[model samples]
Target: MTPRISALLAGLLVLTACSAGSTPAPSPTSSPAASPTAVQPASGPAITISGMTFTSPSAVAPGATITVTNSDSVEHSVTADTGNAFDVEVDGKGTATFTAPTQPGTYPYHCTYHPSMHGQLIVG
Candidate 1:
């Protein structure tokens, strides 16, 4: 065989071998299944912090995801008043998230940056 033809055949074989051994890309309509673990973040409602105040959302489910949106010009945080329930810091005009406690209750949280700024999270 000609030198050029031999080179072309070898390149085609390499490509075929690579594609045959590799896994196909996932389809856009399909999603990877996740194994359940002890800790998994579940998305829920959202909390908006504007005008140096915390606007708590409606009642949330226990062990749900709590997202914080800080629209102020300064950074803020959502910190539990008592035990370490959940703490998430968000920058000015930024957002952050935290996992809610498994036990349902009224959780009072405050901004670690601004002590006067406080909010309550109602979980059912």
Candidate 2:
């Protein structure tokens, strides 16, 4: 075959091979970084841990049972920064609880596992 004709035939063969048994492209998918997270509003006495972060409510009822939720892949804790007012440990994708101090004031807290995670709760 001629040089030009040979080149054309090789290109046609490659195109035919590429089209044979070809499958459609897959669609885009979303990533579920956190699943079934129980995050309450800021006004409520709920604490949520996501991406090693602590999301705490503004204030809670005095001596109320505060809920602590963990959505990360590891365990976490909400411990009082000053005194033994409250301490709660939550497992991965789990929940725990602690009692709020009856004194009407801001109680700072931090995560025992992650020192960078910190927050505060007001009991009034």
Candidate 3:
């Protein structure tokens, strides 16, 4: 083959190989799922209420069930200042579940064991 024709063929082959090895662009839907607003019972995230530190979503929507897990090494109680939104004593590494009030208002809660451990739940 002529030198010119051979050079052209080599260039074409190199271009084809480069294009074939290129990765396809990702689609918009390929991204990870959006995280939940509040933690779930089993598979979902958890709010830690122990000691004097209160973790996770400090406030949640009204009528929403919040799961409070005690990761500390002692028992803890969740009591609302108003009526009993939910009062349960969870052992160490245990969890308690309670639903927020149907009305939208600010509810202050604290741990019976630890008076200093306090948090507020704002339902709207």
* Full-model lDDT for every candidate: 0.88, 0.86, 0.74
User: Candidate 3 at 1: error in angstroms?
Assistant: 29
Looking at model 2, residue 80 earns an lDDT score of: 95
Residue 38 of model 2, lDDT score: 42
In model 2, the Cα lDDT at residue 4 comes to: 100
User: Model 2, 111: alpha-carbon shift in Å?
Assistant: 0.6
What ordering of candidates by lDDT runs from best to worst?
Answer: 1, 2, 3
Candidate 2 lDDT at 92 equals 95
- Runs in model 2 lying further than 4 Å from the true structure: 1-44
| Tens digit of per-residue lDDT, candidate 2, span 31-121 | 3434356465444478889999988887888998888889998999999999899988899999888889989999999999898989999
Writing each residue's lDDT as its tens digit, candidate 1 over 48-99 gives 9999999998789999887888899899999999999998889999999898
Lowest summed lDDT across 10 adjacent residues in model 2 is found at 26-35
lDDT of 2 at 120: 90
Clashing pairs in 2: none
lDDT (10s digit) by residue, model 3, range 80-109? 866877576777888778777788878787
